[model samples]
Target: MQNLTQAIKHLIIINVIMFVAPMLLNMDLTNLFALHFPKNQHFGIWQYVTHMFMHGGFYHILFNMYALWAFGSPLEHMWGRNKFLFFYFSAGIGAGVIYTLVNYYQFNGIYDQLINLGVSAADIQNVLDTGSYNESIITLPNETMREFYSLYHTPAVGASGAIYGILVAFAMQFPNAKLALIFFPVPIAAKYFIPIMIAADLFFGVTKYSVGNIAHFAHIGGAVIGFLIAWYWRKNQFTFR
Candidate 1:
């Protein structure tokens, strides 16, 4: 495994600075880290880059930092600072793009369904205008309102997608690595563990089985991008071994 390098230090510093800048400048930095539904609402296209720096809170950054320390140090040392930085941002952006695409299709699907159901043209316009389902169907019953709320207002915040990408990278390069789930005595090989985790996310995303603001698709997006990246690298003659 590789050791922590300057790139990791630089990333940690940049993230901390961005996280603190919001408070210092009297602006909300939270939106910079988490992608919102309304395209025009964010700082700009640059938020896609800065968003990786802003985290929701302590535990949010904590988990990401820990994962970086665990999986990224090796990657950084192996790839060097410049390459590592490129890989990190690429995965981050890839996650964001894929997430938006999925949301777009689903939102359009709902809009089409509502149109067929004869929701007033005004109501449909409001939903599309504000990007909020609740705002769209204020006249609906309580049961329907519950469903609308589930559709929007759940902004995903965190660096887990990129971190999950790093996890996939590490698992691919070191399939024999022994890792234990939190509080579990058993150690699982990286090869088996990572795939199982990805499969679980896909299953849950498909079923919408869990009730929470988990960006399961984003996680899968990051992992898929990471896998593709590793594949591309190897095909072009880059290999950790």
Candidate 2:
């Protein structure tokens, strides 16, 4: 590995810039980088790719970059720069598409439910188009109305899905590689870690559906796309070498 330097520098820099600059300036980089409605009044269409580069907080970016550097560099070396870049971007874009699917279900569901409860189409349109839920438009009982309003109001942002893709890649490629938890130092292979994490995401996603501000579905979406792409490569026996 003498000539093979860490190939994740650019990924690290992008994450750092996205995470640090925004927090330092007290700006919401997630909104700018996050993919919004096609006619999103908040951000441009370019945000689909830009959002993959942005992260929510220090821990968010740090863990992702760490995983990218840890597992992605090995894959890049095996796949070459061009191929690796292709996979990285493909996984990220795939994540965005899946997230959009989930958001569609959520936004439309909320809109329909609100309209049924006497909310106006104008207010529903605002939420669908801008990710905002108008409190004044809610006509249901107070507790249910408050809960409904909270569900569609906040923005979902991060690179965790794409990062989770990398984790999947790592698990598949090096199923035998032993990974140890720092705090709870049980040695488990990469293969075991990926599935366990996916299961936990699913459980939490279903069980805590009402809890505000978590994009558990997005995590599942990313993993599914990553698995499909990786499986195709493996099935075709296509090696970058």
Candidate 3:
């Protein structure tokens, strides 16, 4: 592995601190830092950037920080600290925005269905706030209703989105680099591996087949933004340092 560049080192440090400090201080920063649904009372504008530093669990931070060190270090070395930081934050924020938009589409779809079923706007809002509804009144499938409830109540945390951006950038820079995953132990070139990863995210995102509380759309958003920026920079022969 390459030595950690200045930006990657500091980012990992900050993420570790954000993850550890709350536990040490006996504080819950999720309401303040994690990205919440726009209509959620806990939602804040600053969460788009802060959520990149907040993590949900030990393995989450471990994988993200490791990816930052492994993939982001090389990009930082190539692009210099300032450029790398810009790309990282841009992709992170873009991921948050895209994630929110997708959620809005899903949320509104269910909301409209309820309204068309003669449910009032206030009652719908009440369902979101209280997580209780007149099951007799809400005839939508239980799974769809549960998804709507989850989308409104759950907040997104972790650096996975930004790490995905770094992964895309790294692949573009080192297309022939061999990469492998734990489950799929066979090594494959970055050019082939990264797209497959993004495709998996997209498939799971659209099909709702993902296990756990994974934000698959956020991964896709990061990959899209990363590819656009990296492609533009390469095409225009742009260099920051």
Q: Tens digit of lDDT per residue, candidate 2, span 2-108?
A: 23334467777767877788778988665566766543456566776787787666777777777787778877877777667677777777777777776666556
- Cα deviation of 100, candidate 1, in Å: 0.8
Candidate lDDT values, in order: 0.73, 0.70, 0.92
Greater-lDDT candidate between 2 and 3:
3
The model with the greater lDDT, 1 or 3, is 3
> Per-residue CA lDDT of candidate 3, range 136-173, in tens?
98999989989999999899998788888889999999
Better of 1 and 3 by TM-score: 3
| Candidate 2 lDDT trough over 10 residues, lowest sum | 145-154
Clashes of 1: 0
| Strongest candidate by lDDT | 3
Model 3 segments beyond 4 Å from truth? none
Residue pairs whose backbone atoms clash in candidate 1:
none
Q: Please give the clash total of every predicted structure, in order.
A: 0, 1, 0
TM-score of each: 0.83, 0.81, 0.98
Q: Any idea what lDDT model 3 has?
A: 0.92
Per-residue CA lDDT of candidate 1, range 21-102, in tens?
7778989756555576543254356656656777777777877877877899988878777777777878887887787678
